[model samples]
Target chain A: MLNIGQHISQEYNDELEDLRNQVLSMGGLVEQQFSDASNALLNGTINIAQRVTELDYQVNAMEVAIDEGCAQIIAKRQPTAIDLRNIFTVIKVVTDLERMGDESEKIAKFASELSADTNSMGFYKNLKHMTFIAKKMLTDALDCYARLDAKKALEVSNMDAEIDAEFEILNRLLSTYLLEDTKNIESILKVTWCARSIERVGDHAKNICEYIVYVVYGKDIRHVIDGKLQDDK
Target chain B: MNNNKVELDQQLSETVGKPLINGTPKITCRDVNVFYNQDSQAIFDVNVDLAKNQILAMIGPSGCGKSTLLRCLNRMNDTIDGCSITGKISLDGEDIYSNDIDPVLLRAKVGMVFQKPNPFPKSIYDNVAYGPRLHGIATNNSELDDVVEESLIKAGLWKETKDRLNKPGTGLSGGQQQRLCIARTIAVRPDVILMDEPTSALDPIATATIEELMHELKSSYTIAVVTHSMQQAARISDRCSYFHLGRLVEVNDTNIVFTNPEHELTENYITGRFG
Candidate 1:
């Protein structure tokens, strides 16, 4: 739970709790943005696409605010040990969240471009499946961080491989489509860009999961092979 | 409830570091214990090495034995009636408890600054000159004047108090007064300086000045500061030792102690999870 009560000074406890709540709120906002952008892309509605782009500014603003909060806590409270790790994790996690929001906005813009042609909507089945898996990975990543659950974070981290494989399929399909059809090249390229954006979002989600593992176990799990991390003491 | 509290107290009392060894220790303490009236114990088996020309801050809650342990460095606890200290403490490889070693002379080499700014009600110049007068550090009038000015300069107070050398030491500001005391300590050219919450009374700006002075001072004098201010300890000290219930809980590099403490008791104390 990352509970930090019982401090001699309760206000310090309150400030730490408030910082965590702010990060969770930002994560929650990015999570909603991910869902809305997915819906906007599949539906190819201009209104929803516009909403997705506009909402990104909020995510960006939250990142700045949360970053400032972390700085203030470090300067004022001088958190140590697990509290320091938790604050450091929040700083790293928010960067990933903002990047995820950026990808979602990019996907929405692609959806807006494709929506102009009714036939292009049929191509969304693969994108739909990809977004579904990516969103699930992101959800699990956020949940594990909220709980500081290393086990769940590892699970979310493993799911990134599936998204990576799907993205390979995406890259293949996009190249093949371009080879088969010259007239629809511009619109097909938008689809390819959208797929790449969503795949990058999956990578960022995986990065967040890695940070969660570090926070929980004090071990850097990034760039590791076969789920192995040297347990740093 | 009683049993649970006892268990929790036992957990918190579990000492972590064993025969702490690091950089060339200026003052080495081994298995030191303090007791009042032979029954009321104030400290447990504690061992720490205060590295040469470095600052080691000892921190914990109120009555956590941080101050008691700091006092052991200069044997300040010996003055208290019924207070007894056991175990070995050496300075520069020489046993401080040796029969030939005088406690009065030992204090000159190991000076101390108290929680409050205690400037003797004498002239500012005399306040700084008192140590050298007693220790005979300066041979002549010119040498004493040089000593007074140098010590005040090192304390970061010479510029402010130079013109007003004859003013009552108590007339200076709280921060200036603390610096004056520090100057007095340095006049004797002490090898080690023990500070007991040296800046708790000063304003933030003043506290900052003393903290900065500590950095400059560590180039010559080893400092062991007992502070309730955690942030100050993190900012100024080279190493940190967390003490709780008379037991030495942990000692490590200041950065490591602040970011990745080893003991559960140390963790709980620094993280403010302690009661």
Candidate 2:
């Protein structure tokens, strides 16, 4: 005979797994869009930019589906404690991914504009560096989710600082280029916008890492002290 | 003057029958069942222990056997011709179903207030004194007056009706009349009190007043109530039993039932999935 308590727990666990899978799928699409937009800027390819734009639609659709799935589970199961945290976190994570998709489209537009300029190599290299860090943070955050590893989530959160630093460097370097040579000002401005988009991607990745902490420990560490993360006891 | 005095003396004797049964459970039910007839089973094999000095709330959906089970607790099901029960139910652990236990006395211990406030069309003092006089909880003119005053005070209706005890109980608002019924029940000093959807008929403010009264009454007497309101159950009950399809789904501490329900059916119901 199946005990009712165990049956309910199993149902809740299954719903959590479904939600986790949806989040991973959404994360995968956002990461791919980030990579494609960066490569388009680096290689001066309009075709890559168009491909990234097309992939944004898929990410948007996945966001809606994941949101509906989370709502259904909450209405049907009424999960509590850790399960409730996981459901709420999935809703927030998917919203962040959807915004990341919008940012990726913005990066793709910047790449298309940069493709038309003569001196694009210097701008491309800076964008590539920013994309590399943002992608790494996103990948690590998703890995933390897959393994349910709070430590890896913390590492991902810490790496966001490096991505922010890269964004600052890109900002200064692009402004210097624009001031020194006004001839290709439009191209430089486009590259700066692309760098800003990548910085936002890093921010979204940091948000996901925060959500992972909430899922594992059931704590809302968002505006609180940083050292509290280590004080899980 | 001679005829009126003779009539008053006769009425007084009918009011006080015998000495009150002291310190005993008003009603006790064990392994009770209620069926629509011989075939349609409503309440399953059930055993309940209702002691004096506590409030128990039975909560579930429309056909979850809560009302049927409440009716059985007070032997109100006896009025239903075909509804029968099995196993032993005792008042103070004495088998109530045995020939020795009178149905009239069983009802005196287990008085009920229903979902809707159904006060009799009589004066407030008359309403409070009706049950005690019938059961002889108090004897003589002065003693019945004291019982009525004390019962209304305990029901929290004395302050509102003390000067107007002679006014009709039905004239009071829905909340007050329900309290009047509670006063009537308390006047008999029953070992247990059965409430069946007592507040469903009242508004939110009235419901709050009744819930507050229930909290106060729990320390002195055992109370068994049936309610369809899940929030009311969560708010007032120390313990709760969830029923579904004539079977008891789960019984646990009130907080556990509301926040961390163990059964999927209970969880689904609480979250508004399927009732």
Expressed as tens digits, the lDDT of each residue in A74-131 for candidate 1 is 8987777778888898899999999999998888877777777765565688888889
Q: Write the per-residue lDDT of candidate 2 for residues B1-275, one digit (tens) a residue.
A: 11101122232111111112235544455556678889999977665555467566687778878888877766788899888887677767777678777888888887889988888899999998998889887879899999998888889899999999889989999999999999999888877788999998999998999999999988877788888877788788876777777866666666766654545555556545433
TM-score of 2: 0.56
State which candidate has the highest TM-score.
Answer: 1
| Least well predicted 10-residue stretch by lDDT in candidate 2 chain B | B11-20
For each candidate, give its TM-score against the true structure: 0.88, 0.56
Tens-digit lDDT track of model 1 for B172-226: 9999999999999999989999999999999999999999999999999999998
Off by over 4 Å in 2: A1-233, B1-30
Hey, what RMSD does candidate 1 come out at? 3.9
Candidate 2 fnat reads 0.02
| DockQ of model 1 vs. true complex | 0.45
